[model samples]
Target: MRHADVAQIVHTIAVETNTPEETVARMYADTLDSYRADARIHDYLLLFAERKVRATLRGGNSNRH
Candidate 1:
């Protein structure tokens, strides 16, 4: 995994859990297995989803078909 992904995960979990960095980090490292494996796997989904979103947005710039 990329450092970017880990950083994003850390920041996002901080916002979501509304906890201190230490607690959120500990939870992420220790209790992620409390979630399904797909929870971790789906972290990669943002890459494709962002690409699709950008493509859609770019397509919108064309007023003509």
Candidate 2:
């Protein structure tokens, strides 16, 4: 995802989860980085990272969605 897209995701998630934007962005970045490290394809990295971040913020696991 582009920086702007990721920023928007972070903002939206923060608002939706009542979490701080900084926290969401941090988690998103970390999740994306982790995924990128082992990913063979880049197409779905952003989507996966976003889902993981959301799940984590919701007190769930990355396996949620």
Looking at model 2, the pairs that clash are none
lDDT of 2 by residue, 1-65 (tens): 47888889999999999999999999988888999898888998889998889888889867743
Clashes in candidate 1: how many?
0
1-65 in candidate 1: lDDT tens per residue?
Answer: 67687567667655654656565455455434433444646664444333333333345432121
Which candidate number would show the highest lDDT if scored against the true structure?
2
Tell me the TM-score of model 2: 0.90
Which portions of model 2 show Cα errors greater than 4 Å?
none
Highest TM-score: give the candidate number. 2
TM-score of each: 0.40, 0.90
Q: Candidate 2 — what's its lDDT?
A: 0.88
